[model samples]
Target: MTKEEAPVLLEVRGLAAKAGSAQILKGIDFTVRAGEVHAIMGPNGSGKSTLSKVLAGHPAYEVTAGTARFDGQDLLAMAAEDRARAGFFLSFQYPVEVPGVANAQFLRLAYNSIQGARGRDELDPLEFDDYVREKMKLLEMAPAFLDRSLNTGFSGGEKKRNEILQMALLEPRLAFLDETDSGLDIDALRVVANGVNTLRNDDNAVVLVTHYQRLLNYIVPDYVHVMDGGRLVKTGGKELAIELEARGYDWIQKSAA
Candidate 1:
């Protein structure tokens, strides 16, 4: 397809999602194009995380209405693993710890699994190790980390870096970062942001979900969206985040109402 005819990377149209009987996302619509960064900001319980989970195909979330399209394909119809294999990646706010799986091994397994699904050859352990080492260097991660269990006993900053390392290796077409900067110190935040900035290219896009404007100071998203009460209420550019930081959510709530 020509660049103009190239499918949109991500499109959400009137999406409604729920957990059990309680609705968490109500008729949300947005789109992300190649080489763009979009930030979604909202107060607690505004359904930001629920949107990410629903896009990633979490079983606990039911899509009660509307549709999500990724690369011109039906996103909600795909299984969770299939979503990942189809070039969707999510960096969770709380990464899990697998005690027995060495970090390097886990990375290899994840990388190879995606490659296998795409009909690409899997990398051997040695090749994969070398590959990941290069990616870790971008994050300034130590060689010793490769031998440790995944996220086991890691510091908050370390866990965040580990998540970026996976993102770099996967080289996803679109990445969803859910509250990635929540617990990091200033220095750690810069490190993680640098890693994210480095990975951005014309072929990929990022959607960052955050509650604080501090993270936006570093990543500098091209567009900012405000969400409240399980719906997207407003959208603007980088300046919108500054406005919200200065005025807080009260003004946004009033305007939406």
Candidate 2:
């Protein structure tokens, strides 16, 4: 079967979400099939991040209407942790710093938890150390990263790289990276993009939420979607990003209006 014929990994229809009585997503209808890379680009506060968070079962957002199904399971019904265990991942734009937790401890626990959920054998620290270190190398991460506290005292690029490292280890079936390209220098961006590109396969899909077209240059999304006013206004192939980059969102927003 071709990539277009791959199984649907995520399906959303009429999805609306609100945070503290402020309605954010008006109506979102999206679908991602296995093996496709999709990008969501929009202005600030266009609900791009909210859409990812809501789909990932963030507690702050309440689903007021519609449905989201992932891998034939009801995604909204799953808890945040359950969603993660179910092979759904959301890489936050601003990864939180865990002051006391060592990166190795955190990654291993997350990896083993998902492994056990999938009825796979859980790796012990030593075994996991070997496995994870190999995965870290894909992101050009040093061994010292395992010893540092998670996201603590790390540069912006380092934090982003760490996020991609977590992604590599988890190997989620559907990953929604929210503005992962933010705050990274060119070299760092290239590394992160390489890691993401290497992880892509016929069985997994990625949805990137970003503001700049620069990220698209490296990732090369199969589909480029323009989100405006909490809804996806337009969608096209990779060339659409180049057009949006040059023409700006004003015309798109106005046209959508």
Q: What would the per-residue lDDT of candidate 1 be over residues 1-257, giving only the tens digit for each residue?
A: 43345447999999998999999898999988888889999999999999998999989999999989999889899999999999999998889999989999999999999999899999999999888899999999999999999999999889989999999999899999999998899998998999999999888899999998999999999899999999989999999999999999999999899
Lowest summed lDDT across 10 adjacent residues in model 1 is found at 1-10
Q: lDDT per model, in order?
A: 0.93, 0.94
Best by TM-score: 2
Which residue pairs clash within candidate 2?
none
Backbone clashes for every candidate come to: 0, 0
lDDT of 2 by residue, 122-225 (tens): 99999999999999899999999999998999998899898889899889999999999999999999999999999999999999999999999999899999
Off by over 4 Å in 1: 1-7
The root-mean-square deviation over C-alpha atoms between each candidate and the true structure, in angstroms, is 1.8, 0.7
**Model 2: CA > 4 A from native:** none
> Candidate 1 — what's its lDDT?
0.93
Cα lDDT for residue 83, model 2? Answer: 95
